[model samples]
Target: MTAPDPWAGILDPGETVLWQGRPDTRPQWAMLSPQRLTLGVVFIVAAALWGWQSAGLASAGGAMALLPWLAVPLLAVGLFNLAGHVLWDAFRRRCTWYTLTNRRAFIATDIPFRGKRLKSYPINRETILSFDESEPASIGFAFEPVPMKRSTRMKMVGFERIADGQTVFALMRGVQGKIERDFPIDPESLPR
Candidate 1:
């Protein structure tokens, strides 16, 4: 007897899974670069000073008592910039899972309190692939617009920090090649 399909309802007809993986969950110390370290330290020191100064005013007035509490958020932001961001990223990565199929790539994240999210990007002939050759490499094949305070920015979506990125990158390239071969677009169909 054959084994049951793990992605029976998840996958489309004829679509086969090429690879599945999870990123490294350990704390990524690389996130705390020199720039971030200096900034975090400065912000933390400033917040502490501000809070200390504001504490003395608590005896003078009513609204002045709340001034010290205002530094709490700043301190939190400073902490986040220092090492909290790295820890948060690791936590998020721990909840993330990646799956690559013949037709598409899937990123599934199940963060606590935030909920589960499953996003897929189609791997078509027109898809542009980007490979980051780092120690634990990354393969980016799609872009998702991330909303910022002022505007939205495109963020690369892919298999991040996977051990076997080269293999996955090759598989993605092969998928694109096979798709082009199977479904050739006629040159006569021109928009220009």
Candidate 2:
């Protein structure tokens, strides 16, 4: 008897599963650079000082008294910027699972409170595949633009920190090759 398909309705008909894995859950201390550390320290110190000064105004009535409470969120942000991000990153990696199929690459993350997310990036003939050849390498194929308050940053989405990177990369190349063979691009469509 054969095992039931884990991705029954998820994947399209005839889509073959190439690889499935999870990221290394080790603490990435290297993500906290000196600049980030300094910024975090500054934010923490400023928040603390503000909180202390505002505490004296606690005797005031109405919204004025609530000024002291504003520092709490700032302190939380500071803590997150400091070392919390490193721990959070590790935790997020632990919750994430990666799957590469003949058609697309999927990153499924299940975080508490935030719930589950399954994001897929297609691997077509035009898709640019890149490999970061490090210990427990990363294979990035797409750039997802993450929106911020003031600006947008491109986050590289891929199967990160996987032990078998080269093999997965080869499989992605095969997917692209198959796409090109199945649907060849017409030369007439080229822009002038």
Candidate 3:
């Protein structure tokens, strides 16, 4: 079999791993289908309008006369559709599974606009993992000691579509096992 990804190297630090999980992509994609469909509708409408104009429809000419009034809604719809596409791609590409290893943490993602960003964080400082059960399918991470606290949250980082929650959970547990095995720490013990 092929070797494990080099990105796993981040866990080599003296810290033990804690948790790792990715969102269910199937559900996420399903949730996004409406947006994709909306975009498709926009495309169809634009195409139909252009086609009617080309077909020498006098009514179409009259419709074009209302361009001033139509511009706002058309622009709004177009921008909304574009934003939806961007957001959908962003979630699919940029989100990732992460492991908090003994000495550090590792993140692998293919963000839409930003491209791929693979980062590892040392466990020396404080990092918090927050969950919203109301949206149980999602998870976020906050890295402290950073200048821009706003950017620290790992928003919408997981599979948008989840088929086997158990499998995902098991994988996370395994990562935790690796962290504990690789980095053992005794919180009660005194360093001095």
Candidate 4:
């Protein structure tokens, strides 16, 4: 039997569900994400090199024992990139969920130790759409800058890292077209 809808009363009275899925939660440590991997690799290598030097220094003399302490942060940072990012990404994926309705898109994430987060963005005519056609395709829309206490993170709320993204994109495009046709967008309220 199929599972019932998770969103019971959250949707509009007549809003029907078009699609729903989650990101692939598999471990992905490829070089595609160069920033984290590169940073992680660099620190890890530095830590290793420093550790070796420290070992050599320790063997040579007792006064050189302070150099190895410098590698501590390097080792920590390296481990953070190499293992930390992977674990974090996996945890995020595991906790995330996506739902696309006729009128809006919903993102629900129940992050471990962070409690629940629910966000809904309407699928209006003024909304811009973009997608990454890679494995576990992702669609981005409803772009907004989410400001935190320290910094801002770009939050393009949509279905991310889902399988068969092309099909979902096509479905959403068709549904969005119908919505636009049924309710023609006014020039004054075009989200300027």
Best by TM-score: 1
Model 1 spans with C-alpha error above 4 angstroms:
1-6, 59-64, 185-192
Estimated TM-score per prediction? 0.85, 0.84, 0.42, 0.69
Candidate 1, 39-141: lDDT as tens digits: 8888899899999999999878889879998888889888998999999999999999999999999999999998999999999889999999996888999
Q: List residue ranges in candidate 4 displaced over 4 A.
A: 1-6, 31-74, 146-155, 185-192
Q: Which ten contiguous residues of candidate 4 have the minimum total lDDT?
A: 27-36
lDDT of 4 by residue, 94-183 (tens): 899888888888889998688999998887667788989999898988778999999999877678789989988887788789887998
Q: What's the ranking of the predictions by lDDT, best on top?
A: 2, 1, 4, 3
lDDT of 3 by residue, 1-192 (tens): 998866455444444555565554432333445665678578657755755554554346676555444445554566556455555654563366665554555667866677777776543323343334444343333343434656653343333333344444444445555556666777778477
lDDT of 2 at 128: 88
Give me the overall lDDT of model 1.
0.91
**Per-model CA lDDT versus the true structure:** 0.91, 0.92, 0.51, 0.83
Q: lDDT score of model 2?
A: 0.92
| Error at 125, model 3, angstroms | 6.3
Cand. 3 Cα-lDDT: 0.51
Displacement of the residue 27 alpha carbon in candidate 1, Å = 3.0
lDDT by residue (tens digit), candidate 2, 28-89: 89898888788889889989998999988877868879988889888888898899999999
Worst 10 residues of 2 by lDDT: 55-64
Ranking according to TM-score, highest score first: 1, 2, 4, 3
